[model samples]
Target: MYAYGIDLGTTYSCMARADQDGNIEIIKNIEGKNITPSVVEFISPTEIVVGETAKGDAILAPDNVVLYIKRSMGKQDENREHHGQTFTPEQISAFILKKLISDAEQMTGEKVSDVVITVPAYFGFDERQATENAGKIAGLNVLGIVNEPTAAAIAYGAQQKSKEDKVVLVYDLGGGTFDVTVAEIVGDKVTVVSTEGNHTLGGKDWDAELMSYFVAQFCEKTGVTADEIYEDGDVLNELILKTEDAKKELTSKNSSSFTLSMGRGKRAKLEVTVEKFDEITRHHLMSTLELTKIALKQAATKTSSKGKSCDQFDEIIFVGGSTRMRQVKEAMKKEFGVDPQVFEPDEAVARGAALLAHFLSTDQPQQTTGLGEGQSAADERFSEVTSKSYGVEAQIGNSMMLSHVILKNDAIPCSNTETYGTLAHNQRRVNIVVYESNIMEENTELSFGKRIADGQLDLPAGLPARSPIDVTFSLDRNGMLNITAVERFNGSKCNIIVKTEGLSESEVMTLQAQTSVIKVSDGA
Candidate 1:
């Protein structure tokens, strides 16, 4: 069985494998490209298109095209329908993975099955399982799911020659998501201390801002309303493409412009300067910095709790395409008092995942090109921390409130016990509704408590009021959650697997069969 590592990104995806001798090789897709844009289009019920070709068709068939489907992963209500055929986000993602795997087989000249896919560090149990379900639908055996920042840290640590272990922070701002992670590197092992991110915040927000700015400029000169232009699918799609290109251009150049053709033979040219771009998107940029600071503070708190002064990180590593923006690095420098290092923004995560694949495939120690032992190869054993708080809604007095059992930043594969008493006498049953919060702040607010799973615990009949019951939440290394509630008096317990909100076994099997019949094009 060949093991490969895949960075299933929001905007783009890449695949790579490790050779027997521990060398990492990136497999170009069928189009002979290193990266495949994460876009999918359905031309018919049986034919699906992926990558650059799908992206190109998006402007023409906006209704049938799906971009940024990754953002919709683990969502139970969101589905894409085209030509009377409905598809789940996992199903769309399966086609993307299938395309990558087909191209990988051509490059390796062998069957690829076992693979490690990387996701954002902040993904919860359901989101991670959705990714695994996509792998299953693609007929690939997912060995494990690694986090993107952890993968990048592994890749960066592989190139360093420092002997002493040091703390490092990774700021990953991709096309559709942003994540900040702090890790401690000791030899080959990279222990992730803390992570914070926004799955909906990324470069797309900047592109949208630029798009709106251009639309307003065009409206002012062409005597057309923004709504009129936006309602035109083709024109909106074209403007989106142009705005994305302009944003990329502004990354290196001080100013950029794109021409828009309005109706009635009127053409408007809209331009934006880098300063204006930064000013317009400054809040989003500051949000990333704020997350960075929070992650760092969490890391520092974790270390200080162990009687160590680890508040300062030795280095800041940048990853993902959005990190190419100048303001990102400037913000990092201003906050950290050091210039952040930019490695291969596009390939770092894939490369790191591939290295871990190599280690998992072989028993040989991971060593750098020239350095040996502690300085070169990182420790194989590492740990991860939870990114969000896990809790249940409890009825306190007259109102329902969040009762957190597992706080964020706690090391994974950990179990904690919290005791709560029965609300009334003879309470025979209790409801345990598990929720993963968007933030660690506890309250009765609407923004918190995204329910992932629930169960009913039946206690002994005729139990007295305020009966002692222990609730334990265990999070495994893969981020799979399990909740156990026990009645201390009788030792009776009920356990529920908090892995709902993703594809079920039957659903996965059905989708697997369905995807098996769909024909994906060989090239982009």
Candidate 2:
């Protein structure tokens, strides 16, 4: 029993559900807002809190505050250590997933076991796998992890019943990340032809600038510097919330006013103009345009028909909260020569994910069979499709989410290789993992059957830095991949092999030993 779809976003998260007849609808959080703040808090390490309540406590523990962790998932070893526990971005994300699932169960009083998670279109193999692992940690039977832009297209494309295929540019800017996905959506299938974006930039960054502006104004108007009154966590948290409100207020009004409650009965009245906000954030908005251009170019390979190129875009759909800014809308209109069509940006992604969940749970159950050690009776229908691509994001210089290949849209059961090299003069071996997706920031360099034994390649010394190396990815019809990397000691070396298998029923049960939960109601 599937209850609803959850869009775990950078700044906000939401849930939705579809009826047996196939109609879809979104679920509102207790806040009365269609979108829920993506902040996840912890009552304890083993227990967590999500949505509005958690957002209230962000300043108290900013590092523990998991937001925008979904943009790209890499390796645990490469992740940062917060407090005492070393958390890979994926583990933090898993905590968020746990929060979402737990909140969903409490809200609907339904038992939810499986879910369809959403990611950015440009998420790489490491990132995608990291998201999957998050679901596993949360004890969820992930139906599928889909691209956020594709998810938006799915919700938007559902409105298009025409037999004629349509290409849409989903310009998705969430609180902490930006994603531009070009999809050829037809019928029930929303194919993510290509995707691009920056994981480090989003609406939150813009809001930070606003906070800075507010702080500066206060120093001038009241002669109080941030260092004087901003040290208090509560004061800072209140400021963050107020700034966000002002940002939203600017969407409808030319100027907005707010009084931030710092502490000790201290309050500051601030009024800001939309023009000022735009002046500060224009470059970030332009980045979206650049990402869109790249996505359009990458999608061109799939849009070779009907005089392709950017002309193939019949519609530019805007999703995510950042699209609400009038400046952003104007920029898009002026640049594209066409007005962008704005949907329920905050709600569409989750709704689309829910729909995809429904489809994958039924339409292509055959694609998900044998994903683990064994197949369930309900999953036997999809036993033919094998393997899922892994995505790893690495920070070369800028933070980027690179994909080797993505899910649902790419050809299944295929193999491909990307070559790398050693960095030292006489160095030989290098560590490599076979990840899924098109992002390139994190290093999740192993597969169940393709890990280089959880360590880096032992290279012989004295080689020039950055030598040639081959990383190969082989997939079967089941969508499983066997990743291998070859390293050189002097002239040539041996290949790195990643080995593993599916989760048998015993293994699945073992992994889920804690408790049993299910989505038995007609979801949100």
Candidate 3:
């Protein structure tokens, strides 16, 4: 009866196990490392290598090696071909997960079956489900998919022995995605207040940004033009990785050195400064602020209606490796009007998920965020999950009522019912298209598809708001949507399913056989 927690991240992956004592310790890889780089390389079309081995083949087998596949998971067109075999992003990622699972089992000396994996808060249905399929391919039963930000909040809040309920914003700019989550921590319970991000933005973007700088430096020293150097894809790839290393090193040092062995030119020193780096990354950092403003306004209204002042959240806690940048911290401070608090950026989410793993496996659930075992008492910070919501309660029509389903800052997954009234006399046929709207001051904007900030599709129609129609939007633990509309007359109903995003049927089935999986003895 053992449980495992895996943080399947864009740049790296880590695993941990919950022992009989309810303790969670990370399982180090063969290199005696707790974090294994999420990289995979194809050997002979059928064979795959991961982590150090994969990195070893990067220079030699550049075309065959794939790194940061997790970033490509939630993408619209993730179909990649290697050696004439079509591999969806999910299948490639599953290979990385499989490698981690096999290595962890060796370290734990036991059969591992159940797992709790981490995902970005901004990951839509397709990406989250895709990660789950990857886990299935590795043969581990996923207990839950926890948001990476919320998990980091839990781990960070536990590390801070504070009893005060505060709003901590997690700025997670990983290898492929950027997610900003504001969480409220009270006692041991940590709840995600609001979240926003773009899946396309991440550290990889920074790598490209630095590559441009590298090109400038190389051209300045060697008198080589972009057309001459970048014409070769291999040279561009080589410079991109070199610049990525320089960017990471500039975290502490003012400048870093890079050597190029191209037949065209001599090596040059790229004098990198924090100010210059921020100058390049300013726009990207500012974008997160816009998202934070939206999240804050929602959180503000949520706290206001609940009678909790937004001022209570004095310290803005951060959890993400990308928060290491000084510019991001400044951006957060300028946006939220508070000093950003960053603790345990890399391991916090996984650590929190591991704690949750123990709670799910065994009953000894310890409240790490000042929230003890049971439900919560009466406080502005949302009390036990009675009825929860994220969006504001507003009128859809003159007489009809509708609830915009959104999670509150302090509230967990709760639904608020909107009562609708009859538009006309004897109106039988009706159309109910669920629209997600973001409110700013008195302005309310409709969200549809990717057009708006976060838009949704049309829900089934019940009887026209004849007699108070009640539409309940339920958000399950998986961040998915469910709608139930009952007509005021005889409770006539309409139900529909939103298309969930993930790996296709054939891709998942094909991957099920390739990975080595450990099957647990059910009797024990």
Candidate 4:
């Protein structure tokens, strides 16, 4: 009967839930930790290990470990083949979810079924659908999928005693992605103004920079060629593991060092200072700053009629475990005059999601202990905006172009219908290709954006060219997409629920059966 919130992160995952008294608590894994490493190791054909234990075995069996799988969520061709069985990103992610749910059920003694998961605000429809599919494959009823930055804001807003309105900027830099969002909080409601991010950018890039530096230094000192080390998976993975540790040490101290044992009883000792670390990774930090600037400008335009400057943000908050780096904090302070506040850098998203899950599960309006009366947790409203522009490919005059149906930053639960004509005389069918783009311009060349979904709409035989066809794009509250094509002449229609890039229906069901029988165990 309890609903839980899960932050299925790129490098780590955490789950939490609101108790009967409305107190949010992070559910710890069997290893007695609030967070579990997002690592999975296939020990046998039917056995898999998740979390810290799996992460530890990564150095020993690099080929068997799956790391940073989040980056491949929506990629159709990205998969792993083990022991004559193929596994997609969604299936691999399901194992992680199953591991977390199994541990959570044991700790709370509650049957965990309905739950809300969090994703990056800038995730496209394909990625979002893939995440939901993963949850389904794990045998959990997914109540909803909340955005990471918005979830963090909800958790922060609930903790505030003030009723005054504030404009908050959330900078989320996680292990595999970064999102910068601007939101307006009024009373208990959190309304997102604008969000911008790169799903491929995050703390792992920082780790890569450090790892490259270590490899170079080691090669120079030990006379070990970079190619020789790179070709050796075990050695490369061991160095990568050490590089991550060194990065953590530099976070709290001025300097840190590690020694790598080269073959033939030779060891290369390396040292990295915090200053040197920052110097090497300055570009990555600047990339985030630039995205923040874009988000701020968009927010200012949306919130003000008089064209106010982007500095109108009342406060800035940092989320995501990667934000724990000292360099990130220092850069924020130097760029923006206001000091950035850290709100539960590791657990805020899951905590906020837990609050939402509780509200969604309750049938009647219930009051939380912290918020004042008349503020029912169930009644709190959340408004989200679209992260990317959605369009369909069309033939305009002589050249093909993308006709936009939904612009980026448009409010949720929005829909748009555009009419187009067939390209050839007596065309038997119309090709409908949906594309999504981060670019703001509309009616641009098809190359500017990537196609997400495509389908063929069969038209009545002998349909003349220039026949009108209505294409409608509808976005639900959670940003899932639905498309409908109608023939104005005959009223015939085609409904397509933009397919997920991860897997087909039959594929998911097959994987679900396979995952159900597999034994997913904790690394501990």
Candidate 5:
């Protein structure tokens, strides 16, 4: 059995496997393409289609096709009903995974059961769990969930063969998400200092911005309401698709023009210059830069105790297919006052993931950040930070407040304990709900986060009002969570598995069986 490293991306996904000689090779899909489109379409009750074919079929069967499913991974109410069948995000993702693994098996002629998947560094606890569940639904053993930026760093280190200690600012702008991570590479170990990102922002947003611009321009020239054109599904889809092409065209050209024909033989033609495109989408790029600065500032704050600043890191490394845009590189140059390096933007993450997969499956000694007593320079260690805060909801006086236990950016494989007293006299049971929050303070209003798990803890009967209960939040290296609450007085304990709101075990099993019956078309 071979362990593969998979970059299950929002727009595209790729996989890599190490050969018997320890050389990592990128595995192409059945179509002989390095990256497969993350698109899935349901053609019949027992037929599923993925990759380029599905993406091409989306225009004709928009209602049956699903794209950008990564954006809905951990949402509480995210589900798609296609052809009278409701599919959760995890199930849609599982179909994608199945396509990846099936093609990989055929391509390599090797059994693939264990794999390491990469996710955005800023993904919350629930999101990470959802990814793991997707792997499980695909009947694969997930070795770990490595962050995309860290994986890219590992690939960069291996490619450059640099032995000196340095810090890298990784800007990962993928098809449907954007993130910035600051990491320090010391010897063979990579430690993440800080990470910031917007899961809803990425190349798709840029395409949408350009689409809106074209629609607005068309409306002005044709004297038609924007809603009138947008209400036409076929016309709108075609226009959006053309706008994406135009965006890609402007990447190298000074301008690109497109024409749209309305009824009554009326048509409108519009030309978009590179400068105008940049002007219209400058705010989006600015948002990414702001996040980059935030990550840098956080890294600086972390290093201030040791007399360092954000300037300690001078080079910016870009990853993801979207980084191929000229405007992105221009803005990065202006922001950093130096030319940024694009290190295998499209393949770095997958390669790094392959390296990690190889490391975990082999008997090679693991790397450590500590002084080397017996560790080799070739071995690599990984460390991650929490993307969101973990806390419990508390009712103080007449208002509800969030009592934070772990703050964001805290190192992983860590645990924190917080004690709280019961509110009512003679309280025998308390409901403990674990929530993932983005707020930093202990008694802050939480406007963001999701409820991961909720359970009841039993206390001694007739317990006094001020009796204390100990709650502990533990996060593993993969960012999966476990919450335990203990009644100190009676020594009673309750454990909650911190997972996302999605299919239960039985539901997942049922879905898995159903998917097994639905044959996926081969990539072409």
Candidate 6:
């Protein structure tokens, strides 16, 4: 009867739960470690391995290892063929989730069913949905998908003995994605102000920069072409593992070195100084700072009514294991005058999510009686804003335009409606194509955004042109989008829950069934 929280990260994952005393505790994996690597290895058609052991086996059997699968979530074409069977990103991710859940269940001697999973704040609809699907495939009840930064804020707010309201900025740079969020914490209630990020940016990118440098150096010393080195998957994977280790080392020491060996006695020892590492990957660090600036700007705009400036934050919090890099802290100090607080760089999200899961399952009231006056316990505890704008395609003048129905940064549990006229007489149906964009401008070119879902509303036959059709977009507290189209003339309506690019209901059920029988083991 324990509710848990999982931080299903890009390179590593962890699970946590609130104990009987209401203190959040990190649940150790079978290896007695707090975090597990998000790597999966398909050893056979019937057996799979996840975590540390799988990560180690990756260098030997590079083709069988799937790492950084978080980057491929919601991709329709990203799949691996093993033993004549196809495994999608969600399927691969399910193995990791299974490992986490199984390990937790074993250690706690209690069933772990209901859980809250954390994702990057800026993750789009498809990525979020795909994450939830992964949870379902793992045979767990996913209560909700909480944003990583928001979770961190909750953890931070809970730890504070002060009841003072504070505005906190969270910079989260994980293994495969980056997110910067600004939130206002009042006692026990956490309200997100603004969030910005790049789903493809993170610590792995830094590792890639170092790997490229290592490859170039090895080529110079061993007289081998880069393509030839890449063609040998084993050697490349070894380099990847070594490069990651070296990156972690550079975070603590001034320099780190690793030796890479290709066959035929071709071996080279490469060394990277911390300064050199920062120099090579400066752009990646700069990209995060740029996004942080955007997030701060957004926060300022949202809080301008209160006469608060972006720099007036009470504290700056850093989350994610990647934030352990020395360069990250130094950059934050140089950009903002305040010293940034690093709160459980690796475990804060899961810890906060554990607290949230407890609140959700028990419907606990707020501690300080701040915002939980009349609303449900969940609403009184947390609030978030939409990270992207949602719109429907419409014909305006001579060009097809995206008419935004919901603007970015709008508070969740919000709805908006727009009216459009039929394009042609006797139009049997009106096609509604929904689009999502990071851009905030209205009536932008359709190319500015990507299509998320589409549905059609049937109209009476022989309908004249310019008939009014109302399109409404509603976003729930969990960030799920639902669209409804109604014809004012006959009250004909079409309702669609925004379906993104991912597996269908039957597909998820099928994969769940297939995975239920497969044995998943933790790597030693």
Highest lDDT against the true fold, candidate: 6
| Residue 312 local lDDT, model 2 | 75
Looking at candidate 3, the ten consecutive residues that score lowest on lDDT are: 378-387
Clashing pairs in 5: none
Residue 318, candidate 4: alpha-carbon lDDT: 94
Model 3 Cα lDDT, one tens digit per residue, 1-524: 67777889887788876565435688887667888778777765667777876765666668888887887775648667777777767777777777777777777677778888988776755667778787877667887777777767766766665567666666777777777666667765666666667767777787778788778877888887878777765676677667777878877787677677567445566666777888887787778778767666665644622357543465676666777777777776776577876676667777777866766655432353354556332122222221122332344544233344453332445565666555555666445555333222221333322211222223234443345666666665655556666665665776534334444556566678754432211011
What TM-score goes with each of the models?
A: 0.92, 0.72, 0.79, 0.93, 0.93, 0.96
What TM-score does candidate 2 reach? Answer: 0.72
- Each prediction's total of clashing residue pairs, residues at least 3 apart in sequence or on different chains, is 6, 79, 20, 0, 0, 0
Question: Which should have the higher lDDT, number 4 or number 6?
Answer: 6
lDDT tens digits, residue span 1-524, model 1: 55888999888999988766556788899788899999888888888888998888878999888999989888878888888877888899999999999889987799988888888988877788999899999998887778889888887877777745878889999999899998888776788888999888989998988888888899898899988998989889999889899989988999998788856786888899999999989999989988888887777766722346455788899999999999899888987798999978888898888877665555453443343454323235456788778888786667788888888888877899888888999898999888887566644543477888898889888899999889999987668889999989898788989764646789999999998998987433
Error of 2 at 122 (Å): 2.7
Model 6, C-alpha of 103: deviation from truth (Å): 0.5
Q: What's the C-alpha lDDT at position 15 in model 3?
A: 81
**Global CA lDDT computed for model 3:** 0.64
The segments of candidate 3 whose C-alpha lies over 4 angstroms from its true place after superposition are: 19-22, 162-166, 265-269, 302-308, 330-341, 363-410, 416-447, 450-471, 485-493, 499-507, 514-524
Q: Candidate 4: give the clashing pairs.
A: none
- The sequence of per-residue lDDT tens digits that candidate 5 reaches over residues 458-514 is 888888897989999999878988889998886989999865665677777887887
Model 6: per-residue Cα lDDT at residue 417: 94
Cα RMSD for candidate 2? Answer: 8.4
